[model samples]
Target: MNPYSVRTLWISDLHLGNKDCKAGFLLDFLNKHDAETIILVGDIVDFYSMKSSHHWPESHSQVLSLLMQRAHNGTRLIYIPGNHDAVIRQYLKFNFGHVEVRASHIHETLTGKKIIAVHGDEFDSAVCHKRLTAIAGDVGYDLLLFLNRWWSRARQRMGFPYWSLASYIKSKVASANVAIQRFENAAIQYARRKGAHAIVCGHIHHPDMKVLGDELYLNDGDWIENCTALLEQHDGTIQLIRWTERCELLAESYAFASLQPDAVSEKKDEAA
Candidate 1:
């Protein structure tokens, strides 16, 4: 990637097989922005459940083509498989157009900032600990996606913006919060130990950018909730962006490898 004119974008948890994947919005975004590099942090596909019985959608295929087009047009793309699509990691050496697959990687920004990028499933003890909970979660998430799709579509007819009902409910569940917190803590600690200034990941479906001591932690969030992403610019600046009724900026801060709280503040005050 060209450091002088290129920007690096990271996104994850797209869950392509789910009806609520929001491929239209994502495709629109890609068509509008010409990034120099794009990183799919993880779970770009919900293969775990997708392989069972659900049929694929045309919108999903369009989104994939859009991405491939960008790669063909000189935009560098990298994909890291998440828990939902962990099997893809087996083909780490493969490349599709300009897109490459990697189990995990270290990204060094133009400004000399170093960060590790991963899908974040390894940090989730429940996902790694047991087979049953993981299966249950996948099934539940799929059902929620089904309802979210039809419900949000109906909402659109009623003049409402798209939103994930499943995500909203998950936020209110205490068990989910506990699980998220545990995962976040693990990622932060791992970054600090690896001597990285920050760690970037996707999973947990929450968008956040935090500075913890000398290390930083960033979760791109997911299409299911915030529909957000993280961008690293050549000037060493890092930004967290959210896509809603349209594209929006959520937060921006310096590129520090350590997870530092308060390093980046949500610019909700600037929302129009």
Candidate 2:
């Protein structure tokens, strides 16, 4: 297949320093696609996990190196710090090896639509106001991801395709659904406040492309679980793609529907 090129690519929740991070898959995805602009929406590195366990593997290092190489190759790179790697927030506005760090950015699409790019943690009440609860939740989430890794390996042994155990649990859990709804509402409202036509973010780990009234809400999902991303075409159309399904879908000559102005709540829901 020929190399695929895009106008913009948004990805996040890599949690690179964590044991469960799927760095090999991410590296493959990056190698397959090239973009004019790349947005690291947040939680690209699991600093909290690294601080606790100091588990930085060669795979994680390779991921970082590849990103820097891309930047050096003239791709405009933007890094927005998320809660897990929030320490980088201190160096906001600094440029490191062609990558610009920022709290948020306003991206103008080819069609003149203004999209607000942020990590989306600021709108998460648990992360913002309930510190203890948030930390507890993070611990639980880590355990879930650990289990998911084992579960996925077992499935692979059985010759089954990749599936997200954590994502399935999140969808079935009532509280998780409520939290996701709240996060989505908060993100849309924040975009409105910023006077942006749309908002692209990653934190909830739910990939979606929805039109709420007149504005759009997009999430790039995560590398740790869903292995998904949000891509903007040269014509300003956006697509939420799952890397795990790419091979099968490409065999069928799949083409995603373009973003429509009047469309309401279209989503490519990923496992949490």
Candidate 3:
């Protein structure tokens, strides 16, 4: 297949310095796709996990290198720091080579639709007000991801196609679904207040696209559980892409609302 050329590409929650990051799959995606503007919607690196144990592999380094290459190649690069990499927030309004750092950005799509692009953590009430509750949730989520990793490997060995055990289980979780709904509503409300037609974010690691009246809510998903990204076609039509294997691409335009949420915390919302 020919390379994927898009108007905008948004991906997030890579958790690069953590073991659960699927750097290999992302590497392939990066190699295959190129956009006029590449938006790193946040949590591109897992600073919180690295604080306790750093796990930077070569593939992770390559991913960063490739991004820099894109920047130097004249692609508009924007980085919005999520809670995991919130320290980078101090550098907002600063430029790192060809990339610009911002807390949130007002973006106009090819079709002239205004969008409030942010990391979406600020709108999550649980992450902001309940510190202990957030941490406990993280612990539970970590255990789930651990089991998911092994389950995926076993499936791979048995010649089954790639499936997200974590995402599947999260679909059955009521509390997680509630949290996700709250975040989505809050984000949509904020966008409406800002007079934007849509909101794009990636803190919950849930890949989604929902049309509410005249507004839209989009999440690019994450590299870990879903291995998905938000892709804007040349005509400005947006879609969620599932990048499982290197050459396989699954475009689920709207059937992903069920696979919602990963983890959220005051400081440690890894995509895993």
User: How well does candidate 3 match the true structure, expressed as C-alpha RMSD?
Assistant: 7.3
1 or 3, greater by TM-score: 3
- Cα RMSD to the true fold for all candidates: 4.1, 4.8, 7.3
Per-residue lDDT tens digits of candidate 1, residues 1-272? 22223378888988898656777677655655567888899989888658775957898898888889878988888999998888887889798667799987788877567788888877756334343243225667667667777888899999988777877777777666666666677888888777776798887777887766567778888876567778775566787877667556666566444322235555531322
Q: What is the TM-score of each candidate against the true structure?
A: 0.83, 0.87, 0.87
lDDT (Cα, tens digit) per residue for candidate 3, span 1-272 = 44578888889999999888989889888888878999899999899889899799899999999999999998999999998899999999999999999999887777677777899788867434343233223877788789889998999999986788888888787767777777778888888989998889998878887776567888888888889888776766666667765333343343222223223222211121
- The per-model lDDT (C-alpha) reads 0.73, 0.78, 0.78
Q: What is the lDDT of residue 219 in candidate 2?
A: 84
Better of 1 and 2 by lDDT: 2
State in Å the error of residue 248, model 1: 2.7
Give the clash count for model 1: 14
lDDT (Cα, 0-100) at 146 in candidate 1: 74
Candidate 3 colliding pairs: none
Q: How close to the true structure is residue 30 of candidate 3, measured as C-alpha lDDT? A: 84
Q: Where does the lowest 10-residue lDDT sum fall in candidate 2?
A: 247-256
